[model samples]
Target: MILTFCNQKGGVGKSTTLYHLARAAVASGRRVLVVDADPQGNTTEALTVDVPSDAAGVADALSDASTDTLRDVLVEGVWDGLTVAPTVGEALNAVRDEIANSHRPGWESRLRRQLEGLKDEYDLVLIDSGPALDTLSTNAFTASDGVLIVTQSTKWSLDGLALLLRTVDEVRRYYNPTLEVAGIVLNQHEALTSGGKHYAGELEAAASENSLRLLTPYIPKRAPIKDAVDFSRGLDEGDYKARPLGKLYSALLEQIMEGTGR
Candidate 1:
């Protein structure tokens, strides 16, 4: 299945969630491909080791003037069962601008076309999108089978959730009819804090209002989770403190698989 882990708000741990989820998928022996559609390249940096600065990437695949296909930019991931279509600095941003200003037709479907021939190569494709509902995000939405919305349990994040859902509705209506909301993941939650609890309740109400599923066991604010991504290691590969978080991601992945019929 092709899933885009998206949120229009930055610092919500979107990339980190996708990175760990990809690791969990790899640990389960599934072949996974991570498409780093974000201009920031956080996912690419997490998944690859010692990549060259000028490596061809998703921007090359999406660029009208470039001959590189998605396959051409795929690099070996840290895990054996994983691969990545990485993005370098400023390239994706430039492509986004080009796409936004272009007079060409079907600008939104460029990433979808790029993924068509490559979908069968991996069991799962996870796209880490930029923190905006702009042209690049439109391409990600157009290309994806479903979207996994990631957000923090905070007032600002909750406010952004409404706009994000509206954008998803628009994408579904115009670009990809079969696209669905895989689920909403509440990342970096502080379960004991009053503020976290209050916002989480609001989030639940928002999900219910929109008929969306709020994934269980909200990801906590933990040092180990951050460390795992920073060290370029899977949570399961980390010390005892990180193993439980790996299990949480594994459960979330299972829920996603079941929802998407994978």
Candidate 2:
């Protein structure tokens, strides 16, 4: 199964969620490949600590000048069963701009083309896209079997979800007809706060209106989740406080797998 975790809004925990999800999948004994398509490289940095600055990555695979394939850029991840195709530096920004400016037909399908034949090598491929609906994100949507929308319980986040859904529809109509939105993931949710409660209600209404499933046991706002990522440790291998949060991610992964029939 291939899934992309994305949102048009930054700081919505897309990278963080994808990181933990990869870790949880690894713990479940599944071979996981994490494709760090985001130019910011947060997922790359977190999953492959101390990756060489000059390493070939997703940017190289997408560039017209390079002969690199996605398979050629694979790097070992922090965990045993996790592999990564990293976005190491500013190269991805250049590639994104190149794709945007080029008149080449099928520019949006470059990543999809690069990802061909990878399904047999890994049980799951999870892509972490940048916080935009640009060519990079379109490529991600084009390549993915499903997209897992990540958002926080906030007014602005809810507003961005509408635009994201529209983009999904456009991609489905044009690129990958089998593409589906696996579900919505509510991250960094502060359940006890009034603002959280208000937006949570709004998010639920929006999901219902769109016939989208909101994955249960929304991730709560917690220091340990961030700490685990920051420290380059899997939630299950971090401080004891982080183990419970790891279980939540495990449950969320199960929900995603069941929803997508993986």
Highest TM-score scorer: 1
Q: Write the per-residue lDDT of candidate 1 for residues 3-44, one digit (tens) a residue.
A: 999999999999999998999899999999999999999889
Q: Indicate the TM-score of model 1.
A: 0.99
Clashes per model (N, Cα, C within 3 A)? 0, 0
Candidate 2 C-alpha error for residue 199, in Å: 0.5
Q: Write the per-residue lDDT of candidate 2 for residues 1-262, one digit (tens) a residue.
A: 9999999999999999998999999999999999999999999988986789999999999999899999999999998999999998799999999999997999999998888878678999999999989999999999999999999999989888888999999999999999999999999999999999999999999999999999988999999999998988888897678899999999999999998888
lDDT, residue 22, model 2: 92
Clashes in candidate 2: how many? 0
Q: All predictions: root-mean-square deviation over Cα?
A: 0.7, 0.8
lDDT of each: 0.93, 0.93
List TM-scores for all candidates, in order.
0.99, 0.98
